[model samples]
Target: MSLSSLRRQDAAVVRSSLALRPLALAVHMLAVGAAVTALPVYAAEPTEEAVTLDAVSITGEAEGGLSDVTEGTQSYTTRAAKTATPLKMSLRETPQSVTVVTQQRIQDQDLQTIADVVNNTVGVSLNRYETSRGQINARGFELNSLMIDGVPTIYEQPWSSGEIFGSLAMYDRVEVVRGANGLMTGAGDPSASLNMVRKRANSKELTGSVEVSAGTWDTYGTLGDLSMALNEEGTIRARLVGEYNDGDSWIDHHTNKRETFYGTMDIDLSEDTTLWFGASRQENNSDSPAWGGLPVWYSDGSETNWSRSTSMSTDWSKWDTTYESYFVNLEHTFANDWHAKLGYTRGERDGDSYLIYPFGSPDPVTGLMGGYGAGSYKTNTTQDDYYLQVDGPVELFGRSHDVAFGYTHSDQDFDADTRGYIPTANYDFNDFYDMPEPDWQPLTDSDASETTQKALYAATRINLADDLKVILGVRSTDYEKEQGNSKIKEDDEITPYAGIVYDLTENLSAYASYTDIFLPQSQHDINDNQLNPIVGESYETGLKAEFFDGRLNASAAVFRIKQDNLAESTGLFIPGKTPPTFAYEEGDGATSDGFELEINGELAPGWNLMAGYTQFDVEDADGEDVNTQYPTKMIRTFTTYRVPGFLGDKLTIGGGVNWQDSIYVYAANPSGVAEKVEQDAYALVNLMARYEITENLSAQLNANNVTDEKYMDFFEAYGAFTYGAPRSLTASAKYSF
Candidate 1:
């Protein structure tokens, strides 16, 4: 198809704030001001009394290695992380920018899903393709890699059942590592990596908690968690968590429900060994989901705006998704102070969606719009991932160093079925609002595919000096894929990583890193042969600091990334094909450059803060900005303060603001006129308050989009746009023992 013809066909087809009393407000203000002034100045030499606040707390033996704080706390800063490197090092020593959303933060913010957390994460942005599917981007590139308990999995449909809609009930904390993580994650972009740390069975005594919540739009949900020791010695423990959610959306005729269950067991095989096994299931169902957004332009080449609650889908449209996983792990420590671990995981995800994709712009004069195309698709994906690794001290050049080696293997299978047909009753733009449902036909087999990967990796932390360290790592991967009648294979692909960190002071450090990027490509070349995998490189330099005895952390970094072998179509057409076929070639790829500054943790004993600023630009080889529809600058911040005396530490209040620069994209109207649609700069505000009615009971309220800011959340080059969510509120009550 020619450019003009393709354009024509694409056009047709694609077509709350909280209230405050004056006296209560003044008290709150004075308390807030006092707390702010009490914060310790990070760099200045502390006075005699200031030293008391920064006192360090130490627990547990080091076991002759670096120890970490794995438990979650209300403070924004976490003591350690596994995503930055295999060795659990504090954020300040990891040589990377890391963010941790602890359990306390999750509850304080009422974050129910992965999307909610990503939206509030600094240096991250959320984009929804439609009402039901969305994606998260960091540093101007899409994030495709996710880890659960340190095990990695690539998203087959990120917008559908991947991290986008993952439940938060079963997770203890969410860890985000910015920049390239290709060293341990295998194949992925340098954008970022997200790790969901599961809540372990750590209770030595019987302990449980239950929570219930209700919010705007008739949203209601409940969560139950129980844990107990199975033996007198408390050597064996088990935990179970379950959650249910049902809610009506802001859009007309749209509703959604979700259910989740998780169970885990921990056993001590001996004083030096331990075992863990677990299983989980999650299901989501949506009724009357919008297939696509309203038209952005009229036939007259003029812009159009619609109400936020408008819907183009009928009552019959629905999307149902289910995901299940099972995992087992064994860990042991030897008398020589060496540690070893073996892990295995298997999971499956399935989704069924019935949609009506309406295309084309409406006629301004006649109010006539193009009709809709109806379709349904069901997909099932199964994956198996396992790895073995061992780390210990090695004496090289009379210096003790930490070394680790591992082998990993993964297998995946996928199948899909689809059916589509035109509705028996059709209407034009004049009757678009009242269009009826389509008569769908039976489903038929679509396609099947299989993928397998094997890798060998090794790394070491060399102690160059008492105050300096160096990390070197490399991964060798073998990959294979079989889809339909096409088969592809690649062997001996190697990716290297290196980093160095120097302590500038007891509480500050500077670091630099270089990482090679590797990503498997599914696109084929003009001759139908799978193109070479996209390979890239990244360089980053940064400074990190910790304050208040590691209770607060901050970092600033600059980075640049480049990739090649990007898939680009030739635009030449092949006849005798239902939709016409076009070949592809390895093209000059993408480049991104950016900087970020972030700070998170307890600013004071009663004050918790998280704030970040990001600026980045991505461009194609031709030097044109890519994804210009996304803002290049953003600022995010939120904080909570505990008020003393009157409430006896029973009341906590906080708020947050998110601001982004304007975004714009170029597109062609139905009349073949070129135009730009843009969303101006906007700021969203949110407020929250939680009060302890009793020692074991608490009540909390949260209001989002207090100002009811309205703006475009997402847009495409073909004249389609989606609006941001409207104002909303939620209230919850929790009981615990």
Candidate 2:
């Protein structure tokens, strides 16, 4: 059945479910009352007795501990993060470069999606190839691993859509670790890893907020978040978050509607044991979504300058995506301070798109474009992941150290189909907006794939001296994949990690780390055999400092990365293939050298700041620049300052700027002449102001692209480009209890 038909069939069910929300809440309250009343009670006179017990020492901290929660911190940085390893450690002790975007920052910037976070994050960039899809990059490589509360999710570019558009409403913060992360993620690139920490049911009292906003391009949105204890003892708690948004884009005939819902429960079975479960769903539906972007050149081999509002999509075109995730976690703390956790996660993604791609270019005088084509595509992906981990303090040479052991298993299945169609007639560039939608053919199977990974890993943090520490880890991964007629298996692939840190002063530390990972490829060689996995190695050294009792942090780092057995296309199709396919070969690979500097946290009593600068150069073995589509130099910074005086104490103001160096791609023009399509260096400016109307009410205004910069947000070697969003404003009112 068609996705549209399915959506139609489910609409009524969804509406009915929504109508029962109040009844569901009533039932939950009743259940809580019943549980409270059923608690055992003993009313017996007891004789006075004295008991003596041995003193117990706690050794390790549990995952998602209070130290990692940034929701109530009101700061731009957290005190501790465990994304790089199972051991909870401060940023200065982690060895690798880590950046945390806290909840305060998210609200200040009005970041709604993961893409928005990435665009504002340090050392990260988003390649928004289309309106509904993007590729995240860092350190001259693509990031393929994403974690939700430490559970890994693998994303393949071809089959994944709207993953980057996941809603951030349910998250407390986003943690980014730069460089190879094989210690936790079994197989992936050396670029970086992202961990999204969810907001738990931490508040025992009924506390919540409601926000409503309106913005340019006919955008409106509402968000609500509620959290409270479900039992009198506060041992059981629950949280619910929901959002709805509808907007029209700067692009002609484009409209978008999105809905998100998330709920979680936390139950303290005992003083030392806790159970957590949550489920989330996000749906993004759009009309007239752009597919590949605008043609970059005219037929005369000259570059074409199109209006920012120009679009190749018809009114009937759309790209809709939905993501659902469910997770459960159990944690226990032993008498010796040891911590053990078991977790399971199920993730599903669905995408349905009917899009048009405009080909060729307009004639310089006639303004007539060559042609346009359309396709109806659908994809579904499901992943199941399970993990067990234990960590505790160990006595070594009479000194206490930390050690962690973990095992993980992940299974993913993906299927895609397409109903392809092509229009027979050409359309004028000026008349493209009136083009009619094409009739889509029946869907046919395009691809199907299954992947599984199992891994065991261990790490230890050893304290050699009062001022010196070292961390060592290793992982053994077993991976298997089945697609088409090809089956690939790799057993016992070992990845190693090492890091050392020395305190230079009470507030300063120096660190160095090394790690490596491998990436499997689907590309085939000339002999129709899949290529070996790419092996990546990263070496990094850095200095870190803290101030104001760890309330502020600063870091500077330099790094080098090398990848072996990288795939390079041969520009030739395999012989006797029904459908032409490009063959690939193992190349000499590439090397990337870079440096980064950053500062985050509160600079003063009412001032919060986050700023970073990044620069890198990557080259292939032939000494030619590679991955030119990504900027080699970037600066991202944002700050907020609340007024201090009596009259102005209720107001806050801030602004920021993001700048990137020029990027270019080589592609052939309509005339078949190879040319360079470039986007020069550009900077976007943003501003925000918030005022407290009362103790429980606040209003905020955010302006993005204040300068109205005209730039291409996306461009590739295919001679297509997308324009960035123009200046826009959003005003919101929020109420808190």
Candidate 3:
């Protein structure tokens, strides 16, 4: 069935569910009360008996641990991660460069959304297409690989139109792996993979937190999180998280409202078996979202210096979205010590926009802008994903090794429609605020696309020596895409992964890795034939170290990536099309070379620090810069220090600075002369402080862009610009038990 029909049914369901919410809440409260009353059954009277220890063996942690998946520490450093490989390994053991943003850091920075997280992450950048959607880039490449609880999923781009904007309250932490991840993500970019680890119901007792915040730009929000053991034996647990936000944008007539709900349950089926189920729903509604940013130039070939609040959107313009998801996962440990897992997830997202675009330079004589239009647009995307994997120890060649095998299947559908003549009217340039809203046309089905992918993967970690290890893996993928009358198929592309690590000392390791990339192409050649997919190789070498008994971590890495069969426009116009079409050819492809350095964790007893610096250069086959609008150099750092003995250890202070090199775009003027508009190097400074008012109450204040820097965070090749946020402040209070 069409997505529109499904949306109608879902809306009705939502209305009915709203009426049942009060009853549901009442039942939940009663259940909590009963559970609390039964807690005494598990509590024993003061025990007078003494216990004796049999053995004092201090065994090291295994590659995979239950605690690694359940609890995320607040420190800047983490001991183990599962993003690089299915098995959890120490950061020093992982060959690739990885970064983790823990829940504590998210709260300290007051990060509300994924965009905020990406912007603050080292070596990553954001490009806002509009207020409702944006893009993320790392290592000079667009990032498209996204995973939730290790299950691969694709996010709708450009429009975002989904839970991409949802609050981060539901996640334990965010992990990023730089470089190709073909072993885990079958078909994707060679740049980076982002994995969001969800919050689990692991608390054995009643524990929760509630927070409220008010910020500049009339932004205010509240969040509540609760977790508890469902029974006295603690065999079952449940957790729920909710958030609400209402805010006004820096642009005139722009406002945002968002709501999110997430819940999960964990059941211990047996001593060695477990089951998990989770569901979430989110809605993000905005009024007067920008179709694009402010124009860069006037018709007279002079630059336009507009205020940050200058908005080209009409009061009637809006972009609203809804997202929902459900998932289940099961795991069992065999008698032989091997572990097996099976998981599945289904997700749906829909959005509608009453949009207006004013896309031209003003008339030099009449000061009138003619490129105006309005339309009603609707889009929906759905995804179903499954995975099964098993890993255990096996003796080989007189040595113990760990091996893992897995299968994954994913199906995704996306569709969009639009109706009406946009810009029903145009007005003079200076009359933007007084311009009337255009009567939008009705919406109808326009186009649809679908893709399905299946893969089988396997990997092994060989302990070649006590201080040496090797990882070998491969994934065989079959992918298919259908768009209108065109169909593309790629059968069984084998991508390989290889890595080696050697302990340089007790606290550090030296490693190198090579990854094969496989990405399907959507571009067409001169004759309309689909271009061959991009096939590439990535190489990297790095040094990783741990300090203070794993409380601190650092890494330095250098890498290079090369891809072939890249689609490049020939700059020639075909005559038969309605207007004209540019022909494309599989050209020389592109290359990127870069290096990164990062250090994070506690520097001392009372101080915490996180710092990183990165630089890269990218060029197309012709040796021309591919994306000059992205900075070639960047440095970001932040640190916090606690006041000892003063104010009873209740006061903490922190600050950070983010700096980037100049970036520019090439555009043509009315006279057809190419000119460059550049945003010079700039830095943004931020300060934060927190104070505990009582045993269960605390307050924090955050000030961003303290320098009040004026700069463009995103610049389009065609002269559109998205300016960075100006100076703003937010203060929040929280209570926990």
Q: Residue 356 of candidate 1: its Cα lDDT?
A: 78
TM-score for each of the candidates:
0.89, 0.89, 0.88
RMSD of each: 7.9, 14.0, 13.5
Top-lDDT structure, candidate number: 2
Native-to-model Cα distance after best TM-score fit, residue 408 in candidate 3, in Å: 0.8
Candidate 1 residue pairs in clash (backbone atoms < 3 Å): 15-359, 15-360, 16-705, 16-706, 368-429, 369-429
Global lDDT of each candidate:
0.76, 0.81, 0.76
Cα RMSD for candidate 1?
A: 7.9
lDDT of 3 by residue, 1-737 (tens): 43334334433442343232323433443443343334223223332211110000001123344223114344766666777777546777888888887777888888888888787788887777567666677887877657887777763332456344567878877888888888888887777878887777766689999999999999999999998989998879899999999999888888999998999988888877778889998888999887776777788878888888878687778899887889998877788878888888998878888877776788756868756766678988899998899888898999988898999999999899987664444577666655676655677778788889999999989999999999999999999989887687889989999999998777667789998677887767777677877877788887777765565677777788887887788887644654566777887777878777787776665577788987777666655666667776789888988888989999989999999887767666655666667789899999999999998899999999999999885546557787778999999999998
lDDT (tens digit, per residue) of candidate 1 on 1-737 = 44444334322331101122334423443343345446765555532210110001111124344333334246666767767667646777777778887777788889989888888888888877577776678877777767787767654432354347779998877889887777777777777888888777767789888999999999999999998999999889899999999999888788999999999888888877778789999999988887767788887777787788877677778889998999888878888878788988998889898877777887777776666677788888888999898888988887888888888888888888888666643346545445666666788988788888788988888999988999888889888878886676889789888989998767667788888667777766556677788877777777777767667777777777787898888886544543656767899888877777778887877688888877776767866566656666789889999897856888999999989877766667787766666688899998999999998899999999999999876557456888887899999999987
Clashes of each: 6, 1, 5
Q: Which sections of candidate 1 miss by over 4 Å?
A: 1-72, 158-163, 364-367, 428-434, 522-530, 569-585
lDDT of 2 by residue, 1-737 (tens): 54334333433332233222323433443443344235333234432211110001011122323243256556788767778887757888989999988889999999999999999988989877677777788988889778887767654534657778888988878889988888888788889988888778767899999999999999999999999999999889899999999999998889999999999988888989888898999999989888787888788877778898887688788899988999888878888878888888899888998888777778888878767777788998899989998888898898989999989999999999999775767777777667777767889999999999999999999999989999999999998999997787778989999999998878778889999988887788888888888899999887777665556778877888998988899999978765778899988787888788788877766788898988877766765666767787899999999987945599999999999988767677776755667789899999999999999999999999999999885557467888888999999999999
Measured by TM-score, how close is model 1 to the native structure? 0.89
Between the candidate structures 2 and 3, which one is better when assessed by TM-score? Answer: 2
Worst 10 residues of 2 by lDDT: 50-59
